[model samples]
Target: MMLQFEGVVATGSAALDSGIGHTALKTLNDVTYLYSVTGPGGGIAVWKLVEGALPQLQDTEYFSGTITFQVGGIGMPATLAGDDQLVLDVRTATGLIGYDLNPDGTVGPLQETGTLTGGGDISALVQFGDILTIAHESTGQIATYTVNGDGTLSLSASIAGQADSMQVLQAGADHFVIAADATTGTISTYNVDQNTGALTVVDNSDALATLGIASPTAVEVVQAYGQSWVVVAGAGSNSLSVMELAGDGRLIPTDHVLDSLHTRFETVQDLAVIESDGHVFVVAGGGDDGVSLFTLTPGGQLVHQDSFADTIHSGLQNVETLSVAHVGDELQILVGAQQDEGLTQLSVSIADLGIVRDGFGTVTGTAQNDMLSGSILETTLMGGAGDDILNAGIGATTMHGGAGADIFVMQYGSDPTTINGFQAGTDRLDLFDYPLLRTPGQLMFIATEQGAQIKFLDEVIVINSSTGGPLTSAEVFGAGFGGPDHIPVDFGDFGGLEPGSSDGVQGTVTVASEAANPGLSDAEIRFTPDGGGTISVRADDEGRFDLGLPSGTFEGELEIIKTYSTASYEITALDALQVLRMSVGLDPTWGPATPENLIAADITRDGMVNALDALAILQIAVGLPTAHEAEWVFLDDDTDLSGITENNVSYETGVDVTVVDNVISTDMTSILLGNLEPV
Candidate 1:
C-alpha cells in the first residue's frame, strides 16, 4: 500500500508551535503534514489538509519545561538513524554545552565537548563518513560532531564558517562534503577524517574553476560510473555548476549551465538530483520555480537533455523550499510555497515535473514603497526599484534595494535582561515594513554564533525595570546586583557541572559555604571588582554567598556586606595545606589550627634568582605547592634568566620583566595562576 499526496485542502492548528528541525519525515505508515495558517490576532485554527486520511500528530506534552535547544549537529531525531541510537549537538543549557537529545526527545543533561564558535542554522548537515559535519549559515563554522556509543555527541572540529549549503559524497575510501559559502560566493571542499570526525579544509577558493556560481545555495552529489559528481546551484548568479569530485576529495569544475543561457529561470536555490535508468535527472526548482533534466557521461560530465522553464506559480504564491523524489513508481515533487504559506505537492509521471505552463508574470506592487520584515532568501521579493521599506533581520541582510536608496530598519536589545530572555508580552515581531516596525522598543546586535541577523524584541515588558523606552530596560535583577538581596530570584538551572574532556561544553558549578563563617554576617553576593569581574556570591542567613560559575576554572570573589566599609577585609580561606592537596580528601577540622599549616618550607612555584634558593626552586619546578600556598622572601637582586635542563641550569633568553625581589616575583606568579573568570 503506497500513500501519496493526493491534494492539499487546508491547515491544522494555529497556537503553540512545534517543529522537528529540518525536513518533516512522513513514512508510509500514515502520518501526514498539516499547515496551520496564522494571523496577527492570535486566532486559533485547525484545518486538516489530509483530514482523517492521516494519523493525528503525536502529543508533544512531556517535552514541556525550560525551552532549551532540542536538536544538535549530529545524527539527530533517531529517525535519522537507527531506532536504538541518536546523536545530538553540543549545546549550552544553564551554563553547560554538549546537550544530547534522547530518542524519547529529552535533553541528556550537559557536558563539555569540543569548541564550536557558531552553532546556529545547521541547514547543511551530513556525516562525511565518520565525522557528523554541518554547515552553518550564521558563522560559516564547518563543525563536525562525533556520536558516542551512549547516543551522546561531542564537538569534533569546526573550521569553515557561514557556509550556505553542504553535501557529503564518497569516492573510494576518501570522503568530502561540498560546501557553498553564502558570504564568499565560493564552493569550498572539506576532507573529513573518519576516525576522529575532524574536518580539514580542502579548497574554498575554487570559484576560479566555476563559471557563474556566484553565492551558491544548494549542492547535491550523484554517482556516475565510479566517479561522483557535484551539482551546485546559485541563487545569486542564477546559475548551476557541474563539478567533478576526484577520489582525493578535490573538486574539478568541468562545465556549468547558466539560467540566463536557457532564458527560463533567473535564480535557483532548492534542487534535487538523482540517477535513474542510466539517466541523470536534475530538478532545479524554487526561486524561479522550475526543473531541469540531464544525461551524465561516465566521466562525471553533465549533458543537458531537457529543462522546464519559468514559474508555473499558483497565482501570486512563491515557492521557497523544494524537495523532489524519484521514489516508488512516480516522481514526486513537494514544493514549500513560502509566500502562499502552504505546501503544494505535484506528482509528475516524469512529465508534469517538467514544464506545465509558462507566462508566469511578476507582481509590480504599489508604485509607492512598501515594507518587509524578518529574513529574506537568496532571491526574494524585489522592491521593484522603489524607495521600499525593508526590515532586514537583526544582522546585515543582503538587500539589493534595486537602484533605490531603500530605508532598512534593524534592531536589537541593549539591556542585559534582553540577553537572558524577554519578559511577558515581549513580541519578537519581524516588522514586514521598516517604518512601521521601527516603533522604537527593539534592540539589534551582532549574532555571536551565526553571522546572520539578531534583533532582540521585548514585547512582554517582563524585565524588573521601572524606566527606559521600547528596547530599553533597567535590569532583570530586583534589589541586589543580579537580583534582590531578600527575594530568591530565578536565574535558571545549572548546566554541566562536570564535563571531563569534551571541547565545546562549558558546564555549571555552584559553591555552597561550609558550616557558616563567623566573620561573614553582613555579606552580599556580588561579582567583585564590580566593574567587569565574573565571580559573585550571596551568603546564607548567617552570611555565605553561593557562587555558581558555569565555566570550570574561575578566580573572583564576592563581598560580605552590601556596601563594604573597608575595601580590603581579610576573609578566611581553607587552610593553605588543605586547599593545596585538594586531590586527596581533607580530614575534618575538629577544633581550629593544626600542624597541616606548617607542612614544609614554602615552595614558591615562581622564579627565585638567588643560587642559594635552589632547594625551594627544585620543589616548584617538580610541580609542588597549592594555589593558596607559598610566598618568596628576598630583596633587591637581578632575577637571573636561567633554564634547568636534564643536566643542569642555564639562565638565558628570559621574558622581558624586572623582578626586584623574591616577594615581587612570587606575587607575579600568583597573578599568572589566574582564577576562573566567568565566560
Candidate 2:
C-alpha cells in the first residue's frame, strides 16, 4: 500500500488566532477525534474523522471557554470506563481541567478537577491505566491523580522533583516514568506501582548529569527489537540522547548522541514516535530545521534518517510539536509550528516507519483458484489447499503454498521473500515489473556469503543456500509471459559481458591545478598508444573527459594541452603521484620552476595557487605511516635528487637538505619541516 499526501486542514479561528500547542488522538467506534489545545487564548479544538476507505474529516468544534490560562498539556486515559464516553484532561497553568467528550464530537462544560499547590505551573501530563501524572514546573514536583468513575481526578501522591516534561510507559506488567528537569539539565527515573498509583525514585542522585543534558524539553518511550528505549531531546544543547530500560526499571545511557550539526536538532521542542508493523521511527520538531526523522535500532540506538526542511517542505521554522497516528492504513504526521499559523499534515507509508516484521498475522486463501495480495508490511500468506496466486507487495514476506501448486508473483524493489516448503518442480516464480528473461545477458546467478544472488542488472534477489546451485529458467518467467514457451534454461547462459565491453579499460581525465581555472575548459586530451596510434578528445567545460582504451597491459603517454601550457605524462601506477603533482602545477622532478606550472598547485581547487596546495601535495608524496608497503617503496626513490625544497625553489640552498627515503629515515625530518621530500 502507498501513502499519498492530503491537503492540510485548519483547526478554525481558535487555533489559527491563538496558536496550537499540543494535540492528542481518541478513537471511539467508527469515529476518530483529534483534540488540540490553543496556546494563548486557552481554547480547545476537536476535529472528527469518519473511518472509511480513507478516513475523512467529518466536523470540527472550537471551545474557547475550556480553561483560563494557556493550556500546557492534554491526554486521555488508556481506556474508557463508560459506554463510548471518553474523558479528555487538559493541564492549564495552575489547575487541571477535565471534559467529557460525547460520541458526537461535542464536549460538556469544562470542570476544574484539581489544582497544584503554591501556584505551580503545569508543563505536561501523561496517563497510564487509571492513574494520571502531571509535571509541575514551578513547584518542582510530579503529582499523581486517580481517575474517578465520574471522569474526575483526585490527588493520590506527589513526588518532589524538578521537571518540565514527563512520559509514562508500560513494559509487560510493569510501569515506569521518566521526567526531564530543564532547570538542572538532568533526567530522573521512577518506578510506578501498578495497583496503588504511586511513584518511587529509582535514582536519588541526578542520573543524567554525566551526559551533560541541558534544557531537555521532551521525552518519549519507544519499543523496538524486543526492548524499550527512552529518547530525550535537549533544546539548550541542541542534541538527542537515547537510553535503554534496564531489567531493574532504571534508565541506562547508550552513549549514542546525535548533535545539532548532524541532525539539525535546533531548539528541539517536542518529540513523537510512530511504530508501523515492526519498524519504529522517532520524529522531533524544533527551530528552523522543522521536523527530523530517526530510526530506532534493536540495541536501543537512534539513527538519523532525514530532515523535512529542504527535502519535504520549507519555511517550517520554529516547529514546536509533532503528532503521528495510524488513520486507516496510512500513518499521518501532524506538524505544529510556532510561527506557522496552521498545522501541516503529511501522510507516509506504514512501511516507511522502518519496521521489518514477519507479517501482519496470517492470511488464508479460499478453495478453488483464488488470488490474495499483501501490503508493503511484513505478512504471511497461506495458499490453503488450492491452486492459489499470492502477491506480496514490497515488504519482507513469507509464503506457504499449502497443498495445490501455487504461483508466487514477485515484483521489482520487493524485499527478500521466502517460500517455505517449496515444490520447486511444480510451483513457478512470476517476475513482475522486471523483464529478466527478455533482457539477454542481464541476469546472473552468483555465489555470495549469505547464499546466492540472482542479479538482474543492478538489482539482486538473494536465495539462501550454501551451495551455488543453478535455478531452472522455467522456474522464473519474464513479465507478462507465463506459458509453455517459457522453458527452463541455464543460469550460466545469461552471464552478461563485462562493463565497458569485454576488452577495454575506462578512466576519467580531469585537469589538475592549484587554483580552479575556468579558462582550462576545452583542453585537448591526447593519448598516444604504445603501438604508434593516437586518440584525442576535448575536455568539457568542467575540464573532464571519459577515456576508454582497448584491453592491453602496455604503457601509454598522455598529453594535456591548454592555452597557457602543455603537460606530458605517462599512464602508469607509479606515475599517479607525479600526475597529481602535474595537475597542481608542481614539477615531479623539482628541477625547474614555471609560472604556468605553479598555477596547477591550487589543489584545494579554490581557484588560486597557494601554499595550502603545496602542503597537500607534500602530504600525499610522503604518505602516512599506515600507508601500504608499496607506497613506502615509492618514497624510497633515492636516485631522484629532487629532495625537499623550500617555497617551490628548484635550487638546493644552504638550508639543511636531508635525502628522505622511507617513513623511519632521518630525511623525513626535512619533509615534516615543510620541505618537499619527494616520495
Candidate 3:
C-alpha cells in the first residue's frame, strides 16, 4: 500500500484525558464528525471534520457535559431504521450506553443503558444494523444484543471465549464476527443469524500461538483476491498475522510478518482495512509511535509497503486507535494517539505492485502527484501529469516529466540520467546527493547538435529539448545558484543537406518559367550577406544553382541579378507590339494587362514604362543585339501584383530565405525579357 503522511491535529478539549484508545466517525447531513474516547478518568471529545481545501478537524465543543466510564469505551455509529438521526453506541467495561445524536452536530440526551451482569471488561464491540456484538476480556464470553427502538440492549446469545478485538464479516448470505483472543492467543470465528441477534461458534483455534503471536489486540476483515481474510495485530509479539476465512467460517492461518526497525510495527494495536480501486489495503497503528501499511496480493500474500514513525513528525506516539473513510476522493485514515494527545490524518493509495515486481522497466504514473523511483537496473520513469518526484536508481535511466512541474533526483553511483521534455524554469534537477556537485557553476555545459549536456566528474545528464532548440544554462538548477543565466556556447556551423555536411552550400535558388514560356536556362543567382558583400553564381542550363555563400550569421535578404541573354530568343515582333500597346492605355493583344506585364515592358530596368523601353524589347525579340540592365525580373509568389500601371510598378526582387537544416531552397517566378504574355 502506498501511504502518505498528510497532517495532524490535536483533540482540543481538555476534559478528555490522554490515552485516546478508540474513535468513531458519524456522518450526518453532509458533514462528518469524529468522536474520540480517552482512558480512565477521561471523557469523549468531538470535532467537526472538514475535508475541503485542507483536510482538518475543526474544533467545535459540541458537548461540555462529560460522561464517566471505566477505562475507555469503544464507540461506533448507527442509524435507527425509521429515523434519519444518527445514534452513538458506546461499550464500556461495565455496560453499554446509547446516546441520542442529532443531525445538526449536537449531542442529545442519553437514550438508554444496559448493564453487563457476569462478564469481564468489554474489550471490543461491533454493530450491524440493529444487532450488536461485544467481546468480554476477563469472562471469555462473546455476547450478542438486540438494540430496541428506545436504544435499550436485549441479550440474544452468548458464547464462551477469550476475545480481545472483534469485527463483523459478511460472506454471501451468512454473517460472521471474527475475533482475536489475546489471553488464549487464539483467533476465533462465530456465525450470526440475521433475523435474531444470535451467535453460534463455528471455528475457534489457538493456531496463532504456534506462530509466536501473543496478545493479539486488533482483528480486521478484508475481502480481497476474491476471498475473505482476517488480519490480526499481535501486540505482545510485535507482529501481524493474516488468516484465510473458508466457506464454513474456519480461519486458516496463511501469512505472518514480524516487526522490524524498517517496518516499525512495534506494539501493534489497531488495524483498519480499506478497499479502493480494486485493491485492499490494511493500515496499522502501533504503540511504538509508528504506523505501517500493507496490501494483500492476488495470491493471498501480505506485502508491507511503507511505514512512518513519530520521529518523522508523524504524530503517532502511542497510537491506539485508527479509523478510515473516504474523504472526498481520497482515502484518509484518522489516527488517535494516546501519548501524543492528538489525531493524525494520513492518506493511503494502492501501490503499483506490477512495477515493483518487474524490478526494472518502464513505469508510468497517474495524473495525481506521484512519488516514483526506479530500481538498480535499466529503467525508464514517466510522470504522466501531476507535479512529481522521480528518483534515478543505479541504472541508465530515462525520465520524462510529461506535463507538470516535476523534480528529477540523482544520487551517487547511478548511471547517467537522460531527461526528455524537461521544461526549463518549471522542472528542476536535484543533485543534492551527487558527491561534491553542489552548485550550477561547478558543472560544465557542452552544446551538441542534438541538445546540451551537463557533466561533473564522470556524471553526465543529457537534456533533450522537445522543441529541438539549443539548450542553455537556464535549464540547470542547484543550490547556491543565482537566477537563470543564458549560457552561450559555440553551436558550430549548422551542417548541409547530409548529416555532418558543412554549410558550404549556404543557399540554393531555383527559377521556373511560366506554364507555356521558355525554360529559364543559365540564370544568374546573387547572394548578399547582411554586412554588404555580394557573391554571385551562375545556374546550370536547367536554371538551378547551389549558392556557395560563406557560412556565418547571414539573416537578411539577398539580391538576384541576371542581365539579358541574347542567345535565347522566345520573344518576336508580336510580343514587342503587345508590350508597346500595354505601355499606352490600350490592352495588350496577347492577354489582359497585369503588374507582371508592366514589369516585363520595363526593358531599360528603370521603374517607369514608355515607348523607348518597348523599342529595346522589340530589338532583342528579333535577335538584334540591344543593351538592357535587367532581362528577367523575379517577384516573390506572395507579392501583391495588383493595381500597377507603368510608373507605379515598384518591383520586389529580393527573395527572403534562411538556412534551417544547413540548406535553404527558394523558388521564384521568372519574367523573361519583354515576354508580355501574362506571367
Candidate 4:
C-alpha cells in the first residue's frame, strides 16, 4: 500500500548534524520513545512518542556531552545480559558509545564505549542478540563486538570493507550482515558466526556502476512470502534497488525502481521497511524535498505506490532518515527531516497500492477497504466488507459487494461482469476508463427480469439489485458516454405476480406430524398442478409457510417435497422392538395401531410393517443404511385411511387441492418412517 502524509515533528536545533539522519524507536511499559542521530555534529536526541488524533513527537531530550560526532544509532530495548533495560547505542566518527536509558525517560551515565582501530568514520550500527556490528564509511572497515553483561564491549572480529550502511538479516539460526559502501559503490554480504560473533566473507557485488546504483547509502531488510529481501536506496542515482538474499548468503539483484517525475526520490539517502496489514511497504527519504513509498513484492520488485512532495505542509525537507513503529493498529514512521531540522511523525493509511491479479478464480477481500484489479479471462471479485474498489479487466468477471459502498470499474475490452449485492445509491459503477462512456446520463439503465443492466456501447454490466429495479444517474460516475438517448425502465415479464397465480396466492400451510405439538420442522412442500409445472415452499421450524404460488388458478396435488433430519429421536431400536411385536401378531397397546402408524412402520414401502421393517429401524438407529424407501411419509388428512392392516395398505405422495378465487387451503399429516411409537 501507499504511504499517506501524516503529522510531522520538527527536529528544531537537533537538525544541525552533518551526516545522514538515523532514527530508532523503543517501547517501555507501553510508553514509546524515539531516538535520533543525525550525522557528525549531533549526539543522540530522544522524544516521547505521543499518539492520538495524530502522532506527535514531544518532550525532546538529549544524551549530550562526549556522545556528539555521531552518525547513526540503535536502541537495544532488551540487552544481552537478559535485563529488560533499554541501551542507547550511538556510532560516532571515532568509535561507538552506549548509554543506559533511565526509567524516568532520562539518559543515564556512560555504560560502555569502544574505540575503532581502523582509519574510517563510524557510519552505521546494528545489533543481533549479544553481537553488535559497526560499519566504517570512509575506510571501508567492519568490526564486530560482544556486549558484556556489565555494559562493557569486547572486540570479537573485524573485516575490511567500505561499509556505509549495514543491516543484519536473521534466517533461523544463521545470521548474515549486509553492508552498503557509498564511497566504494559496492554491496557486501558477510556470514556471522553465531557463537563467536565473527564475520566471514560470503560474497560481494561490486556492480553498482553496472546496476545504475552509483552510491548505495542506505540498506534495509524485509521478509515477504517466506523469502528475505534487501532494499538499497542509492543516493547517487536517485533510485531504489531490491535484491533477494538467498539463504546461502548470496545477493541476487532482481529489480530496481528509479524516481519518476510523479514521485520525488532525488538523491535517496535512507530507507526503512514496515509491513502494513499483509503488505510490505518501503519508505524512502532523500535530497528531494519529499517522501516516497514503494511496495516490495515477493519476487524482489519495487513497485512505486505513492509520493508526497509538499515540503511546507509535509515538513519533509530533504528527508535524511526514517524508522517505523507500530502504535497500536497504526503504523507510524518517524521521518528525520535534515533541512527542517525536525522529525516528522507520519501514519500509514490502509489505502493500498492497486492490487493486480491475472487469470481467473475468486479474489476475496477483508473488512478493510481494498483495491482489486483483475485481468485476463473470467475472474470473480468478492468484497466482503468496507468500501472496496473492484477493477474489471478482460473477459467475464463476477463482482459482489458483500457489504459497504463498493465501486465496480469497467475498462475497454472488459466483458460484461455480473455485479451482486450492488446498492444503487451506495455503490456506483465507475466508467471513467472508457473514453466514449463518460457521464451517468450517457449510459442506459434497463430493468430486466435478472435485475438492472447498465449498458454503454456493446459492453454491458448487469447489477443484481435487491429490489430488482433499474438504477438511476446518481448510481454512476463518469463523463459523457454515447448518451442523450434514454432507455425507459422496463419491468417486462417480471413486473410482479398476476392475480389467480399460485405465487400471487397468500395462504399458510401448517403440517401436523408425529413430533409433539409443533410438528415436522423444515418440510418442503410442492404443489404440482394437473396441467404442468410445480410451485414449492419450505416450512420453517414451526412447520408453517406463507405458501408461494403463481398468479393463476391452481388445480393441483400438494405433496411433501423434502423433509429434514434423517436422524431423529423417534427412529430408535426401542421403536423397532415395538414394530417387531406388531409383526408377530403380539400387539403392544401403546395405543390402538392406526392406519398412519402401520404405514410409518412399512420401512421397506412393501405394504407391510413386519420383522424386516423392525430390522431396518434398528439399522437406522446405528446410523447404517436401511432398506427404508422414504425417510418420511405424508398423507392427506381425509381419505379411506382407516382399517389399513398388515396385508392391505395403500398411499399416495400428493393430495388433491384446487385454487378458487386465487386461494387454496390444504393440510397433510406427516410420519417419520420406521418410527412405531412416534408421539
The CA root-mean-square deviation of candidate 3, after full C-alpha superposition on the true structure, stands at: 28.0
Candidate 4's C-alpha runs over 4 A off are 1-8, 11-20, 38-41, 53-95, 114-121, 137-139, 204-210, 350-363, 370-381, 385-679
Query: How well does candidate 1 score on lDDT at residue 454?
Result: 37
lDDT at 421 for candidate 1?
20
lDDT at 141 for candidate 4? 68
TM-score of each: 0.40, 0.49, 0.49, 0.53
Better of 1 and 3 by lDDT: 3
Clashing pairs in 3: 140-161
Clash counts per candidate, in order, are 61, 24, 1, 25
Which lDDT values do the candidates have, in the order given? 0.38, 0.51, 0.62, 0.62
Residue 169, candidate 2: Cα error in Å is 1.8
Off by over 4 Å in 2: 1-6, 12-18, 49-95, 114-121, 150-152, 204-207, 259-264, 310-315, 351-679
Worst 10-residue lDDT window for candidate 3 reads 486-495
